[model samples]
Target chain A: MTLSADGSRAGRSPRRGLSMRAGRRLWLAIFLAPAVVLFAAFVTYPILSALAYSLYSWEGIGRSGFAGVGNFIRLFTTFPYPRLLANAFGNNVIVFVLTMLVQNLTGLGLALLLARNPWGARAYRAIFFLPVTLSLVIVGFLWALFLNPVFGVVNKTLGIVGLGALARPWLGEPGIALVTLTLINAWRWLGFPTIVFLAGINAVPEDYLEAARLDGASEWDVTRRIIFPLLAPAVTIIVILTFIGSFNWFELPYVVQGVSGAPNRATDVLGLLFYRTAFGEVDTGLQDIGVGSAIAVLMFIMLVTVSTVGAVFLRRREVEMG
Target chain B: MRRLCTAMIAVALLATFFPASVLGQEPAKLSFWSWRTEDKWVYDRMIRLFQQRNPGIKIEFIPFRAPEYATILSTGLTAGRGPDIIHLRAYGGLETFAAPGFIAPLDFEQVPELKRFPLQTIAGARSRKDGRIYGVPFATQTLVIFYNKKIFAQHNLTVPKTWEQFITVMRTLKDKGVVPLANGGKEGWTLEVLSGVIAPNFYGGTTFFEAVTRGQTTFRESAYTGALAKMLELRPYMPTGFMGVDYATMQQMFINEQAAMFIGGSWEIGFFKAQNKNLDFGVFPGPTERADQIPWVSSYADGNYGINAKTANMEAALKFIRFTATLEFGQMFTDLLAQMSAVPGVVVKNPQLQQVQAMNRKATPYIMLVGFRWQAPTGSTLLQSALQGMMAGTLTPAQVGEEVTRGLSSWVDAFRGR
Candidate 1:
């Protein structure tokens, strides 16, 4: 009797109140619907499908039979899986480390130089940002030709300078192939971080830098203490993005190396290894898609773990600088 | 509210199921996707001819360039939206497409001309374990040693008949400041021309390849290592920085007369003739060790067309396959693409093609190198890496052999587990 009285009391209120609440809810649903649907359809569905597939022995076709954890186990005991994974992971780490170091150092240095109001600073920024616009495929093919040991301009120029001895086959030698690939990647991606840092630096309040100067802080001291701290968010973003990009690096090595990650598979990364495993080779039989999916899942897990750890560390360092 | 929910559910179900029902009433139009954009004109003409021959059939030709094709095909296949017909290259992952039964096996009676295709080429299209032909072999290509006639004439060197003579010619050419052979190891497959094809002859001959395939001999014990040793031996004769030169640039070097010989496939005949019409070049077998042992040529189906197993218009698909296999269609396609036709008795009128045709006929049965076969997904990569390592002095021949053996064994194990 008390609940009925409460319900009647609520129902007797103005219809406008209920309609208003309903309208608000409708707007909220409308605003969130597109993104929710897109996320579910593309990202979530594919991930779930891949996870499901990792447990099967299908070749990406017909009936998929359940293999349970057989695919994962094969990663350890199967032919050269251990060695291939180690080589690929090792190469990926090397690429990630080198790309991060080079991109950060070069990008920050360029940002600092541009912040000094040098002549044609805008033009310099434009020039530095140009390569990032190019597709990695184009970048890779361009560099492949540019670094050609026989007739490439690099070697020809070196030969002209009487330093012919210095010009080795950059992409051919196993020791240097990975380094060369890293350098190419850095060159292509340097523009993005530089632009990001430049934006961050521009947002730095001038008064703080002036106060630092007035306090007898040298230019280096001002940059080190003030500008650097202020730019932490940008640095965090760049590092995280670079790390992910390096881990997923596929096109440059694939196009330049022609899918073999050549020079003794010196350039092999997990991306290439995954592709070969799924596709099989001329002498070997075709791969099971189930195993390929399992490898992909493992790669995803690794990426997520690394990204999480990186986010935690970087987020902790990001503090608002007055 | 209940009525609204029921109505919405009805609409959703109708929307989803309507198209499939509608599809059943219409003539199925199949889409044929291919990566051979270079042969677009030829395919277009062939498709036109096919449509005319089969009035009820329709084929939409979708072409893609490299890398993109792989991505697009993978996406389509995964989404169950792949084309009915797909043209596959020799090297990329054919096994992946075939093993899962994504591709339909060609009906032999519908396309009996396939019987005329080389046995090795047909064998390449079959699953190693099941021996089911999943692709229709349409074309074949082989890598032969092309010698600069002018260089040979100037040096008074007969096309070296034996390996010893070949080495002697190289020494003579080296003495004259000309690189003996222009090979690009940068992309790595250039090394295969030496290792996969030429080296087998030096190691164990035809028996060696058979043994490797049968698992009687691993890649390590086979003549492949000897081939690597031989490649290392000739490293001194190759142009400095040859490691960075790609196939095109290497061919360019030969065309410019900067190099004496180019080891490459017959596909280059068209490009070479276009660049220098007057350039005198002759195709010769790779030098051999024994006098009685004829030089074996390496060849495989360049690309094969296969039907998607999910395709609805099986009859139309079979008609298209039959149309392409006809001698007239085969000749026209080959003539336009400047490739050797898989159809027997299809005479190529072009002189350059005639030469290739003659070579194809006279050469010992072409050996299907594992590099071209769909065996291990990573086999080519492994071999390419080992070769690159050997060339860079970072790996020994023994190590190269061991690495390949280990990689292949692991690949085999992975598949077996699956």
Candidate 2:
């Protein structure tokens, strides 16, 4: 309350008002202290520590010394051999692109069908979403057994259906391993996008659809014209999320394919590459923390840069709710 | 009812927070870590015996999956909080731990039984830097072929002593619509085993590896490339999706009699017996490249026990290490664990392990991996990746040989720097 006595006092001596403002700021600082401290301890500290490690030449064991940019140089420029840093990055890109294409389209299709409220709609939704709830490790093992070329149900089923020729080592083939893993990733995450899209569709006012139908517009036309534009907010969120998730793909591949991204490193993504270099893998048998940190810093930069650009691009497409 | 619920909550909270202090008794304890998930019972039984022998010392046995153990153990050790006693994988792997001084060197007086161990057995756990033994040998395992005897008999096949005869047997088995060799190419170690078993014959066994280390020679020479070719040569006789088969899948195929032969370590015997007791299996040294040559098997001491240098419970750790060296421990290891003991005088009664023990005349250090043989641990990694590439038909044998040489060059540089 700006009472005449307070206003006149503030004008007479601004120090009185300044001290009050400082007292208010102190309480604000006190309120935010826990969150600020936690952020510094866990997130800020580790990132900065890893960044420091990237600047040194350190094996997991032994005395670490400064390497300047040597670790980064070796990671970026190692050649003649196929264990190049570029291979992992390229594989990560493929995983991202393939997952976006497969996951988004399938999810959208399922959401559209189910949003009609057909018979057993909730049951179908629940069934499709079941895989998302399973632990990645369990999913990996189940899929590994399912796709086992020798005794796998997939191969056995193929053989029974006179499609024996189509049966092959799905996980073992270098050509198809990454593609298969990306598809499996999409399958596992199908529920998230479906639910998001369904919510967006339902939020579209029924009056908008009814008016279109009364005006003789078909269901498909109404959906493309009215429902989709209103669902733009969810679309943007889903696209950005899919972009981030794809770049971070690790657990499913690591669990199913083992540490080496087996079948000749065909499924070797950047995350696996970083882990193998840093922690040491049974197959790679390397524990070069410096190189691993360098890989991580590089991946961090790429992820941030691409994620920011993706968010901006996706956000630009979002339409205002009418 | 509300007061009763509140009272119950208060009691639970008090118990959770102050139980240990209130109980007023704290036993001296030691924690042990190992990657032997399948052999957990053996360790539990040994721990029971250890606790019985030392009533005051409470030992906790923690097990990790084999592939994940190195990362978990190394990380814990780096944080200065690893277990008091660590079960280390023979030589090559323990070098990483030793390099950082995560493991402590044994005190000769504390474990006098160290004097009884052969220098060769002690050598596996010895630090390459200080030449001090950091751990005691627990057991030794060998890499060799385990074949289904009944299947071999059905095909009227005798054990092949030469590469040519071996190829004939593999081809015959393949022709008869049976998997001759259950190849688990998905794992690099298995491929390494197959290649290591064959590499020795052409490269003059362990002698050649030592000579290469002394000279710092590039493996680009055909001596190594030739062995890679031999590894590739058996691909036709392997399962259709040999690259897809994993360690477990291959084991099942072998046990089920779908496959006649499996190239693996003697460590597989316990698992094989438990999985299919009805299956008849036999052991053989990997065949030689030439008929006149003697086949060399890759043998290495396994399950070497090391102590955490930073451990507070050093006395208990020393006690555990010393006990592992005793004949009583050796007897228990063999009888209960079904493994060959490294305690010089003790032996395992398993016929296959005994056969392998008797065949030590042709045995050599499993050089490809054991840190003592390969200058860099990554030499095995390079070999694994190169072998995988070759199997995938992406690289030639000579290219793989070059990769191996290149990978070891870093180790050479490190040695020269020293």
Candidate 3:
């Protein structure tokens, strides 16, 4: 409800105070120009530029003849051979699934316990949120050091506990590298979902819970009947954020495994591949920009589609809670 | 008032036009980019000395983390913006800088002091595209096996000359409850280092490499097969679950004597000395199967510097490159960085390096970015993946050979297709 200069409703004074309104328009333009310019420069420009590059075959920063969808063709046409595109997409899915199962559930469990006022819950919250403040690179590096087979605390501790035989390379093996990275990512970001869920649980009307408890409801029953349903909105947000993050995952894997995604590219993610194809590596010396741009376009489309669908599906489950 | 305003505007325009001249003979500032964080002192000393010798020029030093340097530099260059001078990796990395005109060719006549460096020592500094030397070569490194002399003595082992002898020595060390090798497998670079030492000896050195480049030979050939087989032979002697160990941990293992030998480049010597001053370590060329085969030591040019072609400070950049060859800079590098200078007359501070110098006749190309630049996965990637597979037991020597051969053929096809 916008007020006019006459102190009337908007429609009554739509054409009133023209000079002053012009001044107001000028001020609005002045205020918004910086943000508008920034959005155009940083976000809109790069996305448009990537879309443009996807149409052509370029080596990027060098001679670029029109390849015209050859990059896309190569990915789709690798029939008899294993498509790197499929492998990378599959890896992202695995990360997303594992994270949703392990990290989210863990976060929810922690949030529920904290809401129940467990012993030293405040201290435990701080401890849990500690890793969130750290940069992903630092987390990756510290985790890599711990997972190192030689002179690493993890393996050494395992040895001290007489589980020396169980001490194996956590990050180097193909069967476990992706899972390890997912777990590390979960460890770093678990606090976000945990806090969100906790906030949602707090916002749930205590009157409903109290009434249920007076009716001889268990704490678990109150939580299931009232608190959990109210947290649907938080669940929707977490699911969408997790989906986006899983596809865009790069830094941790890169810091730990390097650009090659070594041990036979066992840890190769789409982000790493996109970087390698676009810029090349110190060793490869061949930058295929066309393929890299194609990958970027695919990643953007996939992330948007999945996140939108996920949000829509999750939003449908969000009860009115009235 | 009008006259005064006009006079002030005139002075301001003049000031903008001639800032340096107005400021009483200020030095011409040049920006220098480097990633050697720990050895910042070496560059600081070099800059001070260079500044003293050339008083008219001042260089602003900017340091970045080495792992991120390549990406940052590439982005800067692509943006048509960068520092005046940059530190580049040797061989294939330098080629990209030179090939696409990111680095300008140096005027050799202006800096003839660079002649002190052996052409082969800085061969990696020469660009593959233009066949021109892009910058001054500062440091030299050779990859060799550094073994614990105390451990060798305890096991009553001698340096092996043949494959059987090497196997026997490894067996003796393994049976004595010592980790036989300390090679990091997590990053894939150490495996590359391992390939560098063994591949040249078995593959007829440079001759076979040239043939393979010309498409007359494939990696599936017996030379690569045999070398790769030998690569597999040494895997069992490593610590259990060695495939996941990284360089730092491997270094720790060697320092603690948990591992009897560390197969790394000369860069680790300083770290080794720092960790255990009394540690008795000896450098040896890696062992081979045939007694008659001369083992090849992997040599690379270090601290390779290049000038940005579009820089505003050409004269200052040239002076910097020239100063890299001076005895003063060489000594500073050798003393502070604990690495050898390829500048001919530089003093060798570490006596252990002298042992490596004696085996120079057996020196070979540090095989990376050499044979695989023409294809998709790349030569370094091919070898790294092959080595990783061999270690994991997922790939046999024959399978490794096939993988490399496939990469080579792809390169050949792409080359021909292009």
Task: Indicate which candidate wins on TM-score.
Answer: 2
**Candidate 3 Cα outliers beyond 4 Å, as residue runs:** A1-14, A17-34, A53-63, A74-82, A117-124, A207-227, A282-287, B1-18, B21-24, B107-123, B326-340, B344-349, B373-376, B408-411, B414-418
What ordering of candidates by lDDT runs from best to worst?
2, 3, 1
What candidate 1 gets wrong by more than 4 Å, as runs, is: A1-22, A60-63, A279-288, B1-30, B49-60, B68-71, B88-95, B106-108, B114-121, B128-132, B348-378, B411-418
DockQ order of candidates, best first?
3, 2, 1
RMSD (Å) of each candidate, 1 decimal: 6.4, 4.5, 4.4
For candidate 2 chain A, which ten residues in a row score worst on lDDT? A76-85
The lDDT leader among the candidates is: 2
State the lDDT of candidate 2 residue by residue for A1-322, as single tens digits.
2447546655645676677789889989999999999999987898888889889876445547888998788776554223556677788789877876888878888999999999999999998899999888988898889988888899889999999999877888788889988888888889988999998999988898999999999999998999888888888888777767767778988999987777667888888878877878762375778878887888778878987897888778777776
lDDT of 3 by residue, B1-418 (tens): 9999999999999888988745769887888888777667668778987899899989877888876677788788878888898887676667666776888887569678867678776676787666888888877788888899999999889987776887798899999888988876776778888877756777777777667677676777787787767777777887677889877788888998889988888888877988888888988887765898777777767647789999988988888878886888778777776777777887776777777777667776665554455334567766786688787777787877776666555436633322
TM-score of chain B of 1: 0.85
Q: Judged by DockQ, which candidate is best?
A: 3
TM-score-better candidate, 1 vs 3: 3
> Evaluated against the true chain A, what TM-score does chain A of model 1 have?
0.90
Q: Write the per-residue lDDT of candidate 2 for residues B95-141, one digit (tens) a residue.
A: 67886788888868878988998876777787677778888899888
Looking at model 2, the pairs that clash are: B92-B370, B92-B371
Pick the winner on DockQ between candidates 2 and 3.
3
